[model samples]
Target: MSTETDPVRLSFRDVCARRLEWHGLARPSAGSRPADVARAMAGVHAQVISGAELGVGLRIAGATRTDVRAALWGDHSLIKTFGPRGTVHLLPSDDLPLWVAALSAVPPPREGFPEDVRMTPEQTEKVLAAIAEALQDGELTIDELNDEVIHRAGSWAGDLVMPAFQGKWARWRQAVHLAGMRGVLCFGPNRGRKITYTHPGRWSPGFEPAETLPALAHVVKSYLRAYGPATPQRFAHWLNAPARWAADLFASLAGDLQQVEVEGIAAWVVAGDTAVPAPVTPSVRLLPYFDTYAYRVGNQPPGLLYPGRARDRVLRGNFQALIVDGVVAGLWHQRRSGGRVDLTVEPLVRLDAAQRDELGVQAERVGEILEAKPRLTIGTVTVGGHA
Candidate 1:
């Protein structure tokens, strides 16, 4: 390992390939649990639940959507909650304490609502307390929880304020994300078609947030392990934190991190983790929307991971990416009707016979994960990007 003043030098290709290996893409982990995959990837984005399942399933041999769900709602090994950037994600249940502590430490973003639409700090605190109390017994649908919150907190909690889908959301709704990060709220199993919310204690009894400083250190180290040789700007982007705050956080932990030069660009990694493996050979993968690997790589230099058309087609549009040896090589989409799934792949670079065959095999794997029959077409995908 190199010291802060003695930076280690690494190539872009080596760094990219190393990240793939760390993410379990270069070689999937056999017989791995869903939580194992979730923990390794920091957290699996669950804004699109099916996409989250695909992201976790693809990293574990013989895993499927059912397996991920079982870990989430059945075995209590995984918990769905608000994570990085205040986005919904599936994280390891055991790690909730660390995540809650680290995430709660981040300063909240400036209020974006008008004075009349915004909740006062006191109201926000009262709403958070009500959320924790309401979920203490069991799960509650959003509507049911809303009534309970308004009843317990005050009518002020029910005031329509912040803008949402097509209408304004209740003033209390603004505190939901903060409630989740504070270990007071999380997603419960769905009731037929409607989603539900519950307290973290429902699954992990007596759950409590960890100490802030140690939790933050663990989060930073875990990030570097998965996507390291990265700058504070990249870290800030990944965490959705202010650039100045991330830079100061990095400086505070300088003794535990090692300075490095990735293709002449300055970066940092865990102090003892400086080894760079040889560049990976050609490999093809179909990554679903919001896959951690796809989104995290966006912070890297465009020339390295999103060269040429990929920057516009994949990163700019936030489309499902076709990864070839650690770089975004194309776009892909899947449409399912009953037991059949039709996959459309649009490759920016012409694939040879071997690569085409591998793509076919990858398509079959996706079908197995979804329990559908797959029909793959190596042509342009006409569908637009999804949120």
Candidate 2:
């Protein structure tokens, strides 16, 4: 156990390097343990299937997109759901029980929604029940599910036109996604151009909603192991829960974690993993949108890595990061057409021959995941220009 007053001391580089190892980038052969990568990194960002595949594939030594697909849709080892802040993530299916319990323990965040946009307590419950019933044994498209929701719950369920990136919702599957945040609904495989939804009970028949502090403790502990040396505020934001609640949870969990100092910043890691990690390997990465390495790396490092304007430009709207060694060195984007992918990397610093070679390897890894002809462009390198 660590006291708040006497945290173990460390440098910024130590934290950065440990973050890389914690994320599974340091492993020489990660393909053999894809589950370990998801377990350690927490989950794979999966708003885009290709990005999610690359997110997992990048950490693994020789993983194919098929392998990742198998884990989700075939072998059923991983599942796609609205995890951590209502974003799509591919989590190990076995951990879904704990996730449901942890998320359920948090107070509902209705206060944040605008008065006009917020669903009433009754409407929320109706929405939840409608979603689970509609998707009980069969998956349905959001549009199909929305129709079912309106049918079962009432016409009012169709009244809201909520804002969404896949265009305006104008339906209750929007609330079904909120129901997903509550851990009742999850994403099913795409049906042609449309996305589908199903209940986890169908996939993991063992799933049962049980409120338990130990489950939330397991959730927080798993987070600390991968992205720890983290603050309570960071943990709360990650869960989209109230900060004070997170603080209380941390206070209750002191025995399982240790306080640490990173360049004067106070953070916590699992008590069993308090030792400083060895130096980071000179690894290059073509990280995708919401890659846990880029998205869930806490809040402070972005300002340090991207600085003033870089953070806004590179991080906003699900952009990818081009990491050199252990920090954000640039931004990257990908566009796929038919059987080809065009990837553009904008590096912040000039690349040495070795760095460029490693970057090519990283790009090739991304290409392998896409199963498309990859045309990579290394744009003129500069620092923080896109932030």
lDDT of 2 at 98: 79
- lDDT value, residue 380 of candidate 2: 36
Best by TM-score: 1
RMSD of 2: 3.2
Q: 144-245 in candidate 1: lDDT tens per residue?
A: 999999999999888887789999888889888889888899999899999999999989988999999999988888778877878778888888788899
**Best-fitting candidate, scored by lDDT:** 1
Badly placed stretches (over 4 Å) of model 1 are 1-5, 278-280, 292-294
Return the clash pairs for model 2, or none: 31-61, 309-387, 310-387, 348-382, 348-383
TM-score between candidate 2 and the true structure: 0.89
| C-alpha lDDT values of all predictions | 0.85, 0.75
How accurate locally is residue 142 in candidate 2, as Cα lDDT from 0 to 100? 79
Candidate 2 lDDT over 1-387, as tens digits, reads: 466677788776776677777787765354455556677777776777777887787777788788788888887788888877777778878887777777778766656556666677788888898888898888899788888888999997887567777765644555654677666789888899898988888877868765688788888888887777788899888777899999999999868888888788888888868766686545677777667343445444566656444466565534588776666777887778998888789887778888888888777878887787888898732333222
In order of appearance, the predictions have TM-scores of 0.96, 0.89
